[model samples]
Target: MRAIQITEFGGPEVLRLTELPEPAPQPGRLLIDVDSAGVNYADTHTVENSYLAASSLPMVPGAEVVGRTADGRRVVALTDNGGYAEKALAAEHLAHDVPDGVADGQALALVIQGVTAWHLLRTCARLAEGESVVVHAAAGGTGSLAVQLAKEFGAGRVIATASTEEKRALALELGADVAVDASPEDLTDRLVEANGGRKVDAVLEMTGGPVFDASLAALAPFGRLVAYGMASRVPPTPIEPARLMGRSRSVIGFWLAHCLGRPGMYHEPLDELLAMTADGRLRPLIGAVHPLSEAARAHEDLRARRTTGKLVLDVRA
Candidate 1:
């Protein structure tokens, strides 16, 4: 089997596509012949040795993938590691069937991002009908899905922040009521104005650093801010404890990987999300697809923020 191996931690260049022995499933696990692998911003951090789970040298570095079980059923899995490979092992419980209506790449794109967005809106932030929500990186994998999910969850208004005009337009197309340039200066003000001078009730914040502070400021009283990723590569800064006290606002952190560790936690939401995708209410936009051998270039595209929606590795090709 061919796999992208991270022999060392540094940049996208560290990812190497090389021949490797096929992986087999252990007890309670299933072997997946990978058709596609999802590339996330976290994959970039993992390659740089900056993610929550440090990688062992010469290991594959992908989290979610679409593949087939030994029985030949099409499925997607959130694996512990080794997703950037032609073959990988997945815990049976973490695997879910890919709906017949969803294509392999689309299914793989939705599994991780869709689940994360679903949990964020439905669980952590508790988005309510008629409430306003803000989504940072609204053009990226999770953000794109989050925008649509927020609308489906009955949010009255959705404000999205993106780095480029192209990305901003993409957000609006996905149901964001308004899109703001993610420049450090005007994000909060623009978001507030877009919401008719009302602070948002919930914010799905992925970028950290400067944007974190702005997101905090843009919250309404009792607003919930859910921090999932720090794609900006900035260190977590001190948030004023008094801010939460004064405004009755709350900040919560979420990691889908951690949430999935609890038994039965992910199943219900995943089923609902998949049903939405199958029914055409929710769509996973696959922005880029790369051959397995071009994994390094794929990583570069993600790290450079040149790709939007989801990037997937086509292992079968």
Candidate 2:
């Protein structure tokens, strides 16, 4: 099997492709003939040993894969080991059947990004119908899906923010009520203005620093802001508990890793997202697909913000 292994924590340059032996079978784990692997911004953090969970050395770096089992069932699974190889190991329970209507790359998108978008809205933020929501990085993988899912869940207004005009347009096409430049200089004002001069009720925030501060400042009374990732690699300012109480606002944190193994948390929402994709209600944007050997390039493009939507590695290539 061919895999991209990192012997030390560093940048994309550390992801080196090499031939490796296939993973031996383990109890309760199934072998997958990997077709494609999902690439996430978190993978960048994982490589640098800065993610929420610590990563071990001399290891492969992908967490989700779209592949077929020995029984010939096409499935998407969350792998505890790694997915950046021709063959990988997946827990039987973590694997879900891929609907025939979904392509391998699209199905791969749903595993991490899709599920995170769903949980951010339904679970962590507890968004209610008719609530106003703001989605940052609206053209990226989770952001794109979050934009559409907000509307699907009956949000009264969805404000999407992106760094580029093209990305803002894509967010509108995906169902955002309005799209605004994500520049931090006037972000708070723009977000409120986009919501008709009113603060938002829920926010799906990833980038930290000014983006986080601006979004937090634009929240309505009783608003909930969920922070999942810090793509900027800059931490947000610490919050004062008294300030949140005075404003009746919440600053919640969510990590998908924590949702794993919880009943009806991972699989249920994923199934819903998969069904929506099958019916054409949700579209997974596969911005770039790289061959397995070019894993470093994929990481580079993602870190540089040179690409949007879901990034995938075609292991078979």
Candidate 3:
């Protein structure tokens, strides 16, 4: 089998494409013939040795893929590692069959990013109808879906933040009431102004450091801010519990891996998400597609924030 492996923790330059013997199915896991794999910021973290948990060396860093089981059942699967290859192993429980009419790229996008987006608003933030929200990285994978899901869930106003005007345009087209350039400075003011002077009821914040502080300030009283990722690769600004108490605000954390530890936590939402996608209520964006050999470049694009939506690696290409 052909795969991309990081023999040492470093930059995109470290992701090397090489040949390896095929892996066999474990007692409880199925071996999948991967058609498409999703490249995520977490994969970059794995390469840099900076994720929530440190990665083992000589690792294949992808965490999700869309592929087929041995019998040819189309499925979306979660991988602990080893997704950047023509074949990978997936726990049967963690993999879901891809519905008819869903493309491989779309199904792969739904595995991690889609699940994250769904839980961020519906679970972590406990988003409510007619409430307002500010979604950072609004043009990216999870952010794009978050924008639409917020509207679908009945948010009164959705404020999306992106790095460039073109990305911001896509955010608006996805149902955001307003899209603004992402800035650590005055982000609260910008979102408030965009919301017609209303502070947001929820903020989907992942970038840490200065943006974390600014996002905390942007929240309305009693608002919840779900911190899911540190895409900036910086230490998060600490929160003052006393500060949150006075405003009745909360700072919450979410990790998809944590959900995997809980029994049946993902079933309902995954079903809803799949049904939504199948019926056209949801559309997972495939920002760019790369050949398996170009895995390093895929990492480069994600680390540079040069992507607009989900990035997929096609093993067949």
Candidate 4:
């Protein structure tokens, strides 16, 4: 099997494509013939040795994949590691069937990003109908899905923020009621205008650091801020209690991996979310497709923000 391996963690240049022995399935695990894999900021963080959970040296760093099980059934899975390859072994319980009409790349895109959006809206934030929300990185994988999920859940207005105009436009296409450039100094003002001068009930925050404070400020009274990722490369900053007290706001941190570890906590949401995609209420966008051999290039594109929507690596290509 051909896989991208990190003999040492340092930079994107360290990812090397090499041949490895094929893996076999254990009693409770299934060996999958990977068709596509999802690349995320977490994979970038892991390559740089900055992820919450440190990976072993010479590791293959992919978390989500869409492929076929040992029995040849199409499925999506969250692999702990070792997904940037032609084949991967995953626990049976961690895999879910891919719907009939979904393509491999699209299915892979949805498993991680889509599930995150679903959990954030339905569980973490408890988003309500006719409420307003502000989604950061609205052009990216999870952001795009989050926008649709928020609208499907009955958000009266969805305000999406992106670093570039192209990204903003993509967000609007995906279902955001309004889209704004996120680089300006007065994000709160822009968000207010987008929402007709109304404060947002929830802010789906993926870019952390300074954006955290701004997201907090943009919230309505009793609003919830869900911090999911720190794509900005800034260290996590502390928020003062007074900030929360001022608006009676709440900030909650979410990591899809944590939820995956506790299957009982996320099973229902995952089922409903997959159903939404299967039924056509939701769709996962495949922004770019790269051959598995060009895994490093995929990582580079993601870090540079050169790609929007979901970036998938074609393991079979």
Give the best candidate by lDDT.
2
Q: Model 3, 65-94: lDDT tens per residue?
A: 888898989989898899999999988888
- Give the root-mean-square deviation of each candidate in angstroms: 1.2, 0.8, 1.0, 1.5
lDDT of 1 by residue, 126-222 (tens): 9888999999999998999999999998999999988899999999999999999887686788878989988889999988888888888989999
For model 4, the stretches where C-alpha displacement exceeds 4 angstroms are: 261-267
Q: What is the lDDT of residue 21 in candidate 1?
A: 91
| Candidate 2 lDDT by residue in tens digits, 1-317 | 89999999999999999999999989999999999999999999999999888899989989999988999999999987588999999999999999889998898889899999999999989999999999999999999999999999999999999989999999999999999999889899999999999988999999999899999999999999999999998887889998799879999999988888899988998899999999999999999999999999999999988888999999989
The residue pairs in collision within model 3 are none
Ranking according to lDDT, highest score first: 2, 3, 1, 4
The TM-score, computed over Cα atoms with residue i paired to residue i, of candidate 2 is 0.98
Error of 1 at 139 (Å): 1.1
Candidate 2 differs from the real structure by a C-alpha RMSD in angstroms, to one decimal, of: 0.8
* Candidate number with the higher TM-score (2 or 3): 2
Candidate 1 Cα misplacement greater than 4 A, ranges:
none
**lDDT value for candidate 4?**
0.85
**Residue-pair clash count for candidate 3:** 0
- lDDT for 273 in candidate 1 is 80
Residue pairs of candidate 2 with colliding backbone atoms: none
* TM-score to true structure, per model: 0.97, 0.98, 0.98, 0.96
